[model samples]
Target: MDKKHLQTPSQTIGPFFAYGLTPTQYDYEFKSWVDNNMVADIDAPETIEISGTVFDGEGQAIDDAMVELWQDDGEHKLYGRFGTGTEENNRFIFKTIKPKSVNGQAPFINVILFMRGQLLHTYTRIYFADESSLNASDKVLNSVDAKRRNTLIAEKVGQKYSIDIHMQGQKETVFFDL
Candidate 1:
């Protein structure tokens, strides 16, 4: 007779990330390693604010989600993390500089979402709506259906950008598999 080993069950990604990764947001004693501010100099010419809400399948705002942003413009590489529970109306905001096109690719910010029901975090990209030319030529952007492309582009509102992420439903965001 031989003994067999069993694999442990996978747990859903969640509220734990909000407590550990976004300590300050949850009123923890210590600060998080990464914060919503990605720029070292707040007054940088390209500095901009990205704000949005994370909605659930029912189209209700999720107050406990954690969002992470990553950008590399061949010059500046920055990362920012935010928890929706800290903000009013469950919005996540990131203060970062606009990324520049690298190797002919359209300038975009990579986003990762971790929510209570997800077994693993989802990945997406935020393309600037103003970068029409570059966006039209971007391989990754073009790969998505023309109608669904809007789901990935962040709209310019006043001096900042805004984009809502819908976890499900008709307006669901385009998440990529890695």
Candidate 2:
């Protein structure tokens, strides 16, 4: 990722659109999660800062990259899928609530990144706070090779979280390849 913003194409390649891709709230069930019930909403006015410069293995910020995130309802929602991309505008700020573990399956959030001028759209899944014991038990994280697991986590910094993504560079985030 380069510190300086680079120009990328805004042309739509599929069903998703450009920035501010409105997360359709077609599923009524998703409402529960966005409401104050979910953990991310716990601190109503407290904004969890999710800040990170997308970087390449060489340690350069990738500019003009759009990042989309989706996560499950952290409030014990009986029927939410963590990585399925089913939650509605579960799209809160780029910063999200810390995911929890269930059934020995640690939670994770989906991320879709669009870079300017790049033909390839990158897909990745981000894990919750690594400090939690659940980080050790997350099935998704566990499934990945130990050497690559670190690529899936983001470090939380006070009110802001930071994770630099390396696009077109070595040591990139673990992409879903979808």
* Candidate RMSDs in order: 4.1, 12.0
lDDT against true structure, model 2: 0.53
Among all candidates shown, the one with the greatest lDDT: 1
Give a tens-digit lDDT track for model 1, residues 1-178: 5788786765666566766788876889877788999996445776799999999999899988889999988788899998899788989999999988999999999999888888878999999999999999999998998888999999998779999999898889999986
| Candidate 1 runs further than 4 Å off | 1-10, 41-43
lDDT of 2 at 57: 54
Q: Candidate 2, residues 1-178: lDDT per residue as tens digits?
A: 8598977765633433322232232333223233212344345454344445566456755444455565664553321112112333222235345555556776766677765555777788766564557778777777788887877776776665556556545576777765
Candidate number of the best TM-score:
1
Give stretches of model 2 more than 4 Å off: 1-47, 56-59, 74-93
* RMSD, candidate 1, Å: 4.1
